[model samples]
Each structure stands twice: as structure tokens, then as C-alpha cells.
Target: MNANQTQINSLSAQSNPTPIVGIIGGGVAGATTALHLSEQGYNVVLVEKNDSLVSGPPICHLHAGGNLYREISDEQCIELLKDSIESVKLYPHTINRRPTVIATPNHDQHDPQSLFPRLLQVQQHYKQLIDLDPSNKVLGEPDDYFKVFTKQQLLALKEQQQPAHPTTIEQWLIPFAQQVDLDTLRYPVVTVQEYGWSVFRLSAQAELSLSLESKCQLQLSSKVTNIEFNPHQAKPWAVSIHSQGQTQQLQVDYLINACGFRSGSLDNLANIKRTRLVEFKAAYVANWDDNQLLWPEVIFHGQRGTPQGMAQLTPYGKHVYQLHGMTEDITLFKNGLVISDNDSQPKLPTPLLNKIDIGWSEEVVAQRTQSAISHIAQYIPSFNSASLGGKPLYGAQQIPGDDVSLRATSVWFGEQNYACIETVKASSCLPAAIKIAQQLKLTGLEPSHRSSAAEESSNKALTESDIEQYAVRLARRRGYPEALALYYGQ
Candidate 1:
């Protein structure tokens, strides 16, 4: 046997083969942690109640700089930029290389220039990252990170024919310029190198990669019934899970809660009290086949939770577009944002939980989707013709605290070897995993001979065609259009 294998076998002979890490939830956060831990020579048991991974929340935008939220701090934006770059590096195939347009309506008080200072700071940070490693140029040239276009410029480009394939940022803006009402917009609209993220494609990569890793035991369609903490034992956490109509127990050295919004539920089971907020949100799907022009993800910014809240239109291939209006009647429902009080788990109202556990009613889906279409039509008048494309991409996300405006977060270490990942955005998953790995090292539980499993798995021979086929199948399985799987401008 090889020296590394001999060392591993010797370790196994001592009754401590490798640390078994039990990760609850198969969302992006959990999958990422499992992948990283397994790569580091830990046996990972990833338990998810769903049949597929990354089947939670609608993640359309990469949030490269937290550009969608105007109210968030610049520090948060910079962190987002860093995290997003790392995510793109890990899952390069999932990114849709398209710029996003951030426009301010005339009714909004904030000017487009108000965003320039923060944008400039983000740009500089991006440039530094590229300097550190040229491969960090995922967002495109840092010099062209953001561009400003006045109403005159947009009007001038309104008549320009949309390119069959958009190479320049301006070409990507032609579709929006033609359809959007220029009079209602502010003087300048900012186009950033923020790209689109395909959750289905990300799911495909994670699922396929984890399947190939023998160290990771991905338990899909498995529900964690209970968890017991025995700090004195070699395996501190005893996780009882139900899968395939059978109940089984798994003894794990480390327990990671990456359950997204339901993370607090596991904390409650362990009797760990934590203050958190859970918000249920959904984005609608609409098909605009009438217009063949490709468009960048467009954002018409406004105050949150108001009638004229932020409106986002994300274009998927095959003329399918996802829509989000951050108003009470649309994406944000009544009592959608709930906080943990006496218990760690915030109790979402029964009806909302039903929509989560069960599925949303067809009537509700039609109503909300139609509302979203009309909301987008206010900005892009021609969008009124867009019809409901598929079921809404929806889920609940947990915020670390009550700060609803918080966009970027990482891992939080609790008692013992237990860690809870608070990933507000998909990009935060990688950093969270890295932090958890660091924590594991501090415990001195990391194996002596670090396996190259994760590195090898990450560099596995997979072509773009492989990803497209798997992503399309995943999307269709999840009741979404195949278009949602295909990257725009690919």
C-alpha cells in the first residue's frame, strides 16, 4: 500500500479512522461544507429532506458587490464581491456572463450617482483581487466593472439591433433600453459586471461532484428527526434520521447546521438558543417569447416593503425570465419575516409553512405571477405581454439577526465542535465551508495525510455539454422550465 493509505489504515486500526461530520440540509451551504470536509479526509454524511440538492431559494443574481441593495454598507458590498469571486471560481460553469442594469425610477429619492462611491470601492477591491491572482477576473475587466449611461445615451441605443451574442455591456443593454420607459428613469443607469447565477446548474455540479466522492455520503430524502449532544463522547453528536421509511442513528464528531431558514429548528432540537430571523420570499417566472432580444438582468430600485418596491427582471434562456418585486403583495408576504423569540426556531405561520412543506396552490401561483408581470410592465411597457412561464422559484432564508438588509454572512461556531452556517447569499457558501475547515483544524481533528479528493473532484473531467444536460434535467424535475437551466449568452 502507499504511505498515505498505510497511514490512513493505521489510523483506522486505532478505532479513530476519520472524523465523521454530520451536515444537516442539502442546500448550497450544506453541500459546500460536506464537499470541503470530505475533501479534508473527514467522512461527511449530508442529510437533506429533499430529493435534490440546492433546491432551496431562488438564486438568480450573483450579488458580486451587493449591488441590488442600495441601503447596505460598502463593507458588506466588498465582502460580497470577494465571496462571489470565490464561488465563481469553484463553480465557473454556473455563471451567466451578463451584466446587470441598476436603474433608479424618478419616484425614488436616491440618485444613481449615490451608488458610484460604493461601486468605485468595489471596483478597486476587484482589481486588487485580480492583481493577487489574474484568474479572479471572473467579473470581466475591473476597469469596465461599472459603466454609467444617461437617458440620452439609452435613447440613442434604443434603436440599435440586439446582438445575436452580446460581447460588450452596451450590446446587452440594448434590449432594456428599447423596452423600458426612459422618461421614468433617472439621468444615469449603472451597468455592473454582476453576472447571473444558475441555481439548477449549481445543483447539478454539487450533486454530481458529491456523488463521485466516496468520503461524502449524501443522504437525500432523509429527515433528521432528533439530535443529542454528548460532549464527553468520542462522537459528540448522535443524529437520528429517517430515510426510505426507516429510522437510523449516526454518530458524528462534528455537527453542522446549514439548513438555510430551518437552521434554527436544528438548534432548537439541540436546545441551543439563538436569535435569528426567517423570511419567506418567492420570485415569479414569466416567458416573453414575443421579443427575441436578449436582455441583462434589470433592476428598478425603490424603497423596500412599499407599493413601489424594487423590481428585478432576470432573463433565462428560451425567453424565460424570473421576476421579483420586493413589495408586500408580491415577493414579501404578510408576516413573512419572523424572528426567533423564546425558542431558537422562528415559527412561520402554518399556512406559509404549508406552502413550504406542501406546494403553493395553483391559484396563488397564478395571482402572484400575474402581479409580478404587471409590476415589471410598469417599467418595461412591452413586458405586459409576458405570460406565466412556470412555477415560482421560492423558499425561506434565515438572517443571522433581525437586520433584514444584511446580504453577506459566513459561519458561526457554537458550543463544542458544532458550527452553524449563516449564509445569506449563495456566494457565502464557500467562505462558510473554509471557516468551518479552519475551526476543524483548531480542534486538531484534521487528518495528518490530507486527501486530494476534493481537489481531484473539483478538477474532474466534465464538459459544458455534461453540465447543460444535467442542469436541464434537474430544472425539469423541479417543475421549472428547461430555459432556467441554460445560461444566457452561452
Candidate 2:
């Protein structure tokens, strides 16, 4: 045998009796889980059906709490954003703290400060929601400016001979009045918290790098066909994997289903009682030549009774940007549980949903690409002038709802020692990983393993854009930024 194969065989022959966690899926969720588990000194075997760790077309712009969610308290919202920031920081380089702005079409002109009253009222509504929920606790201190800001106080900042302490609103809008373009929709540029854009390839690299440490075994391009429960033994699962037209059995103490869209299928194999709903939401990336047109991530709002449901534009620097104007949400499930092939029916809005499924197809991709370009052109007139980058990217995700609320991260099915995660947001992956590790009560680290923590601490000075730059660097090394075009375009 060759030297490299001999070395790999030597490493694989050395077996450990430590508890094993079998994690299915290699997306951010599964990767983070395996990394955390390995850090805690447990053996981890992470299996993915795809060759690469991050499969499917790229998804970009990890949304911090600026505008995504609703019906949750400001505290909970801010916490989620903070979690997003912290999670990205775990990687060596991958996030950019680009400013995000929301722009409404010009109408009756009002001072930018006038919006503070409505914002304050919205905060009060959230405060009431917090008061009603007894279980919800404000864990960390949220941004004071976000929690409390009065119009009178902000106005005083403008009136003062440099008032001692200015509110965040006044600080952000110092040049707001001067830059107001009444003719276009660039009037009230609300500077939100430093929203970071997570570079897709770099993020995948970071997650995979962290997981492939001393204790973790990664199996790519392997499919789990069946899982047998071994309740009588310490290792509770005998997972049967199919790869390269061969079958093998692996004994594992714990099984975590981190399969994002196909999590429901894995759960069913474990005989776990649950239902899964999925949807196909069309999206596209439009790259423009005008660097001056680049502004903070823009969310365009429509007037009452308008057909458009909040369109989004996030700049990925280098004169390229992404656009998502969600068409009618095509529901993949009817009422409750998707039992069989007949029950799991796709309610396709466009024929493209069938033609271009989870993966890309040429004809459907072309149709959806045109649809995306046309939809964004209505609100963004400049899109008409921009050139198409390449073939349009398309993909879908499982629908998250109240029926699967408690199991959004990880939940234990009592019988089989199986846990399933339904992670809708990439930001939730790290926190979910730590939580599942604690839930499983994995053992503490050895003295040698403590060096990992020290290494992480030493690399603490990296910036948000460092990772994006790293992604660009790697992409250039590979001759093109094909996978990273949605974040850092070439």
C-alpha cells in the first residue's frame, strides 16, 4: 500500500471505547454538534450524503435580529442577534459587520427623528409580551438604544451645544437630513446594529475544520439507510450506512439528526413521532457594476394592499448583490404529518418547483432567474442595467412552525436515545450544539484536549470581514469564486 493510505489505515485501526455520537447531515448544525461533542472528549462520526460538507447551492446573509422575526420580545430578539454574532466569531474568518438599512418609498416628508416614536411604541409592545411570559428571562443586557429611546431626548441632542450623551438615533442620523433624497427612496436610512454577512464557503470550512479535530471521524458521501435501536446495551443505536454500493454497521451511544430539510425522514427511521412541513421559496443573486449604488442591506416595503411581500437587497461588496423577493410560499405539506409519497405533495406555484427541485436544473433555473430579475426590477429600477452574473442559483428549506417548536434545536425521543434538530437559521447552530452537548452530559476534556481552548483564545483578534476576505482568497486560489458569489463575488 502507498504511504498515505498506510497512515490512514493506521489511524483508523486505533479504536477508542469512549462514547460515540452519530450525527447525520453535515450542514452547519451537524458540523457544530460534532465539533462540540468532540471537544467534550466524545467520539463523533458525522455522515453526509453530499461530497462537500455544505451541499446544495449557496445561501447567504445571515440575518441578525434587525428585521427578520416578529411576535418575540426585544430581549429575545436581541439575544438571537447576539448569538448570531458570537457563533460567527467562533470561526477564524467568515462574517462582515456591514451596516443594514431599511428604505421606504418617498412620501410626505418627515424628519428622521419622527420614526423614533413608532419604534418606541414597538418596544413597549414587546415589553408587554415579555411581562406575559413567565418562563422567558432576559439573559443578557440588550442594546440600551434599542430598548429605550425617546424623541424628546433625541431632539434635545440635535438642539444642544453638543449634548453630553447622545442617543443612538441622533448619532446615526447626524447626516440623515442632509442625505435625504425625496425624489428616490433613500430618505430615512435607519442604521441598524452591525449586521454581519456570513461567507458560505468559509463558514463551511470553519465548521468542518473545527469538527475534524483529534476525536471526530468524518464520513462524506455516505447515506444512512436504516437505524436499529439497541436499548439493551450502553450503545443504543446500530446505524446501517450505505456507501459506494457497500453496507456497514456502526454502533453509537447517541444519534443526533442534524439533517436540515430531510430531518423528518431521519426521524421517521428512528421511529420518532413527529411531523415535517417543507416549502419551496424562490431566490436569486443580481450583480451590478455600480459601486456607488452599494448601500447598507436594503429592505423595500410596499404600500397597503400591494402585491409585493417585503423584498430584500444585501450587498456582497465588489459591485455584486443578492435579491430575494419571495413569491407565494409553495407549501410542501397539506395539513399535518407527511406520511408517504402520496401525503408529501408539493404545492408548486410555478412549474419550476418541480423541474428545479433541491438541486439545480438548466430550464427551471433559467425561468426562476428571469422571474427574480423581473420581480426586483419593479422596485429597484437600477437592476434593469446590471448584467447577469452566471446561471441563477435555486434551492429550498423545510418550513419551521409551532408544531415543531420545542424540537427546533434538539429533542430526545425517549425510546431510541435519538435526538433531532430542525434548525431554520444557521446562527442557532452553535448554541444548539452546546445545549445538546450539555443535554447528553458528555464527559469533560483531558489535559491534552485543553490546548484547543487555548488555540481559540489566541486567534481572537480576527475581524468580521477577515473570513470573507479569506473566502475570496481561497476562491481566487481555486481560479474563481463560484461558490462564494452570493457573499464575496469575484
RMSD of each: 3.8, 7.6
Those runs of model 2 whose alpha carbons end farther than 4 Å from true positions after fitting are 1-17, 56-58, 70-76, 105-187, 291-293, 302-306, 329-363, 400-415, 442-490
After superposition on all CA atoms, how large is the RMSD of candidate 2?
7.6
| TM-score between candidate 2 and the true structure | 0.71
> Can you write out model 2's per-residue Cα lDDT over 1-490, one digit (the tens) per residue?
4332233334334454556788998877788777767766767788887665654324555545534333235554455554565565555355443444555554413344554554455445435444765322231112322422233433443443422232333443332222323244534445444344544654445544653376667777788899888669666688787776767777777888887756667766766655445544444555677433324455555431134545566666566656665444211212322222422222344444443443456564455555556655665565666555444434445544434222223333344557776555666677777777776763332212336564453234344454455555544543333434234311
List the candidates' TM-scores in order.
0.95, 0.71
Write down the lDDT of every candidate, Cα atoms only: 0.88, 0.52
lDDT of model 1 at position 434: 91
Clash pairs for candidate 1: none
Count of clashing residue pairs in every prediction? 0, 3
Clashes of 2: 3
